[model samples]
Target chain A: MMLISAIILIIMIVILPLETGRFLERFDKGHQNDTGMVFLSGFLLQLVLFFPVALGTMFFIRQDNFVWCTRIYLILSCIPAIAGAVCRIRKLKEKKPAAGPERKAEVYKNTGEEKNGKFRDAEKTILWAAFFIILAYQLYKAVTTAFIDGDNTFYVTQSLIAQQQGVMFTNLPYTGGPTSLDMRHALAVLPLWFAYLAKVSGIHATVLCKTVMPLFLIPFTYLVFFEIAKRLYPEEKNNIPFFLCLVAVFEMFGSVSIYTSERFFLTRTWQGKAMLGSVVIPVIILALLMIAADIRDKSNANIKTAWYLIVSAGIFSGICTSLGVAFSALLTLGGCLVIAIRDRKPKLFAMSMLACIPQAVYMVLYVILK
Target chain B: MISRLWAYLELNIETVKNYAGTGFLLLIYAAAFAYLLISEKDKAKRVIFVWIPGLTLLFFFLPPVRWMYMKYIDGSATYYRVLWLIPVAMTIAHGFTRICEGFKLIGLPVAVALIALCGGDVYHSVAGPLVIASKAQNEYHIPQEVIETADIIMANEQGHRVKAVMPLDFTSYIRQYDTDLYLAYGRELIMRPDAYDELYSMLCEDPIDVEKMREAAIPRQVSYYVFPKTSGFVKDPESCGLEKAGETKDHVIYRDPEELEYMSGISYYYFTD
Candidate 1:
């Protein structure tokens, strides 16, 4: 049962996002080949899309009973997911008649490309192996060892409460007594999402968080880093693997202090705040790179999707932690402002601010409710 | 306001120091950023590797910017997160990789050494044995004693939910395993200096007065008292009606017979409502 739930979680996080990413691939010619970006786009698409419906359902219910909210939200959110799947299937069907020769030709082209590509054979293979070993080691440690943190009193307990009681953040985690709505934490419903996963999978929330989550999060974060590497060294695909090995090593030794993102990633990867720091921030950086690359190429036609990515990242940020709103806004708007000024494109700055509407809305809600 | 900003700057520097321990990674990052700024020919890569990070660092240190951030978002404690905007590892990796690409033979080993030196072992302990990761006691990852303690209490609990006062160490994990086990006061009070509870303070005090503890627990309807065996008390708790119900490896569970009877009578009505 536990294995099944873990597999289900992996599918929900990885396979569904990949399908959604396949659907989103149509919007950008550049990112079609970048699997990391596609997965990120699909992941953000899920998050940004799921958030509003979840919030609306929460509002409609008014009592914050996460059991019903999660159930209904799960059903409703699957509409987009199913639609994305249908679109992918239809597209595949359309291509099927022509796919035989085209697929063969594409495979031949890839083989030729690989022969000419800058990715060195032996060195690239070694780097790739090292990266996988590091990833596997991290996962092994995550599953076997437990890093105790104080904040779980709130975050994990919130998931456990919602799983056990069907309520949201209505009960104070420390004492297990009824509490008034904590507007600050109420809107950041990552823990509720954990509850939803636990409820559907029939796994205890604590085990899902402590043991299962890191398996996905660590790899997912590296995916974002891999995307960044592709942007940084696009011409040198070999360098990408080396970059990942370095990132894994840095993260392994990143506990310079308790406050560093590396420390958070290693110790508290399951938490929303850690997600914001490790995953969402890096995705935002990737968005900036995508935009800058498109702009520099004067292939500004497909740049609209990058802005959408920023918007999705912004909402996804708010979904992770309320503080994520400010951080994402600062990165998106600030990075855009810099890019705009340096490149002398005022429109880019304006579009960046426009992309921040979701974040802005979340902030307004937080302030009014707070 | 100026003084506040000055204080904030000092706090920010402290945060930076803590985050950048030994400052080796930052030094490597600075060198990487500089190398990228000078040598990177790609315009798009330059925007990410050079421009965005430079501006972010400027904003991070700028007094008015720091002031606005502190005033609006959060304080200096979390200010270190702003530094996260810089792609430290990526920058260093990219720069070092590019630099090493020139000297193909020894470059990889040199880059590896520099990075390893820059980064302290995450599992390295500053104050004690370096055993950061250990086999989890249970699926919950909380202490096995906490799980045992919860099991004992749940076996003895007469009500669907019962209140207990345990040592501060167990406050966070007890309710996580079983929400029915309520704490009179919790981790929030211990972590937050402003928050205080009289019973919690009394229970934590050395040589705890049994009669006074009884006085405090009565009003809160605290049915169980879990104390470390090493804990000192002014008098035997049994003298004040708390009978030893069970014992774990590290803790002794003493149940208030009166509180249990009271809870038995009122629990259904008290809890279900």
Candidate 2:
């Protein structure tokens, strides 16, 4: 069964997301986004599309037959991602994307590109050096501390249970039976998604939850940070290294900050709460930057793509954790209010607020749900 | 109130003094944040670089917010304040960017100095403690002896999980290896007494309250009583109507004379204090 599952996962993981990302890139201006960003955005979109169905399947079927329920949940979840990739391909024939690896992530208006100089190569070398140095330094802090914290135990137990029992929200870890656990059920299942993949891939749930997320997501997090920095200084190529330098050198509050996103990224990256703070918060910041750039550049078509990105992020927030969507709404509402009142771009504000609806709905569920 | 405030101020001063290098880096972030906020033009960029860090620093100063989190939330705001590190990182980034841009041709030298300065802080504030903790975690592992004993008992159990009462110290040692079985007294926050009430003693009070645990086992499920060979607990399994089922080199597993009731379901309440 494990071998069967592993064979299926190997094909589904990369190919589907790559095709989906390439197709999704079509809606953007000349497809002028970064390759990594497009891939992650497509992956995030797939996660958002498939989560509800996977969760619904897990709930009813899990009690009767756990193994098949897990297999069924995974199989059902892959459909939308695969289908969306195909549909997007059929829709977007041959207008090539000009983003990501193809070109530098766009600068906002015409502030002009960086001047060629002897210092430029030195600056980039220093930038790449700083990136690795910071990555290693933070990873040291993250990996060493281990999951001695409270919520770490909570999510570890949940993920482990999913791997062992092939069920969700049913078995208690200490004394096994149906869980009377109540909060928002939406917040409860984020760990299960990681567990599902671990189940099929034959990786231990603990290692996936602990090592893999920080190892992978933290680097992607830097990419997200770079995109935001690029949007901030679109033409000032010198600023790219400056942005990275900031990413590396800032250790603010030090160990005094017991619960910083840095701490979460290093130690608790696997948990839903950590994902919300580290991953989703940064994505929200990136979306806000893109929205600001679109309004400034007055690109209506790009504006459409940007709004779609925000909604996709919002949907991801719902599946990732309840707090993610709530934070998304708070960030969008705050950003929209700023743009609406200050920039007098009420249309942009209105559209951004509309984009925040999925997040708002998720927040409502968090508030009203039993 | 003034005296209390003075005491609080002194304590914080001491904390800052313990690692003055971090304090200095924090000061750099603050100064840069303030200067950049005043000088920078782009409000959008400033939000990421300036206001977020500034607001978080503002959160640090607000004693009421600090107190509420300290009192009601977790015992400290330090963990929740981890979010502030983002702003702090950006603020440091902001400082580096400003210095490099200011120096122009000499920016590389300036960048080197900044990295060195921050590296010093990372050493004192983070790296020193991280090395110690990492070493401790690597060196202190559970013995293979306990793990093998657990494996033998599990293999003999005919695919059914046996409920066992043992010392709480070895509970994690057993469960760490496998989860198919139950520990009547384990490291869970929410644990209820099994039918024989063997768990109430070791967990509820410090010394083993053997008097409370001596009641005979009730029949409805499988039950086992396990103890290490080095145990100081009263070793008579017959008191609880359990017969010695098996023994390993370091441990023994005792089975109930009759069937025992199964305990299942989430332990609804947990005691923290």
Candidate 3:
């Protein structure tokens, strides 16, 4: 049963999300080869879509909101995943297109460009080994060590309640007493997502959140960093492994204080606030980079998709943590304003504002509810 | 308003201090920014690593922006998240990688040494590693005592869902293990300074006032009480209306026979308030 549950969870989180993300690859023609973006796009798609549907279900059908929401989301998600699979099949069948300049550069660069440099294949191998070792150490600690936070009394309990009782926010997680909908936490449905995973996989919610989650969240976070490294060193692929090694080391020793993103990333990987700090924020930065690149190259075809990704990221932030709603918007606006002013494209600012509309709506909802 | 702004600024500074710790990583981050600003030729990389981070640092430090944020967005407690936009790890990694582009042998050792020397070892911090993380005893990652206590309660339970008065330690994990069990008071009532409940105070008090607690709990239909074996009690609970149900390694479980009888008389659904 444990093995079955593990398989089900991997399929739900990894395979299905990647398949769904394959459909989003259509928008960004430049990044067809980028699996990192595909995973992110699909993950965000699920989260962004889940929030409103879950909200609407809770608003309209108070009882069995968990069931209805889970079923609806699962069915809704399959559409994109299936479409992505078909797209993958079609792409596989089509005649091989000649490698573009960028693709050719990616292929040529990782190997021969650094022949004369001090960093050889062996050094690169060492860097790669170091990176994997760091990752393994973190994962080992995450699995074996039990880091108990006071907040888990609420968050983990909430997921368990939703999974076992099939109710959303109706039961107080601390005790089994009834509660009115927690307007603040209800909007951030990360716990509900956990509940859905537990319910589907038949894994205990506590075990899943504490053990299985970090396994995915840690590596998934690194996947985001890997994509960032790729972007930072598009030409110097050798540096990519070293960059990742640095990142892993930073995260390892990042327990500067309890408040740092690094501490939260390692200690509270399953929590919504942690995801907001680490994943959602980095994603916004990645999207901004992609958007800026698209604009500079006059690549409007995929640029809109990148901007739309910002929009989706806004909603995704809200799904992860309520504070994320504002943080993502502020970050987007800040980055976009700089881009707009630098490039003399005022429309970029407007597009950023448009991207923040969902977050604006969520904030307004919070204010009204508060 | 000026005073409020000053207070917010102090809060922001404190947040930065807490985030920066020994300031070594932040210094590395700053050095990375300088490197990127000077040498990074790619327009996108410049925007991402240098300009955006610079603007974000400015935005984070500005008191007015923080005031507006605390007032309108969320609260001051989360204002530190504004710095999350800076991409500290990415910048440091990129900068060090860039600076060491040519000298692999020296650069790798230097980078690793700098990180080790400057950074706090997470596993050996001020509180010690055990406080942060210890080997989980079970698949649930719950303490063995908690699982044992729950097991005892579950074994003793009749058809009705168990409504127990658990100590503060057990209150959190018990419900996570079994939703059918309810607590008399929760973590919120204790953790939140402003909230209060008499039953919680009386039941959880050291040298627990048994008669007063029983008088208070009987009306609420609490059927069990699980406390640490070392807990001080004014009187033995079994001498009162309760019976010694079972024991775990660390906890003594007691059941109110009268309350159980009372609860069984009425058909109670687990979902009921």
**Clash number by candidate, in order:** 0, 22, 0
Could you tell me which 10 consecutive residues in candidate 1 chain B have the lowest summed lDDT? B264-273
* Candidate 3, true inter-chain contacts retained: 0.60
Error of 3 at B124 (Å): 4.1
lDDT of 3 at B267: 16
* Model 3 per-residue lDDT tens digits across residues A1-370: 8889889898889988898898888866766766787887888887777787778776677576788878998888688889999998898789574363453433444455524344467787888888999999999888887776778888888899788777787777887756677777878888998998898899989888989999999999998888778767766677999999988898878777767788788888899999987898888887888878877777764575577678887888888888888889988999999989988999989988988989999988877765
The 0-to-1 C-alpha lDDT of every candidate, in the order given, reads 0.78, 0.56, 0.80
Alpha-carbon runs more than 4 Å astray in model 3: A94-119, A298-305, B1-4, B124-130, B158-160, B204-206, B261-273
- lDDT, candidate 1, A1-370, per-residue tens: 7688878787777877887787787766655555677788888787766676556655555454575677776776566567667877787787753322222211223356533334356777777887898899988887877776788888999889888776776677898677566667878988888888788778888988998888888999998898788667655666777878878888877676667788788787889889988988888888898888888888874476678778887888888898889989999988898889888999989988888988898999988877
Ordered by TM-score, highest first, the candidates read 3, 1, 2
Q: What fraction of the true interface contacts does model 2 reproduce?
A: 0.14
lDDT (Cα, 0-100) at A203 in candidate 2: 66
Best candidate per TM-score, number? 3
Of models 2 and 3, which has the larger TM-score?
3
- Give Cα distance to truth, residue B220, candidate 3, Å: 2.0
Could you arrange the candidates by lDDT from highest to lowest?
Answer: 3, 1, 2
Task: Write model 2 residue lDDT over B116-184, tens digit each, in one string.
Answer: 554443223344344212321321123354455566556666545666676555554454344556655
lDDT per residue as tens, model 1, B117-140? 877765552324444556777778
In terms of DockQ, the best-performing candidate is: 3
Off by over 4 Å in 1: A26-30, A62-64, A97-119, B1-11, B102-106, B125-135, B205-207, B232-239, B261-273
**Which docking category, incorrect, acceptable, medium or high, applies to candidate 2?**
incorrect
TM-score per candidate: 0.90, 0.75, 0.92
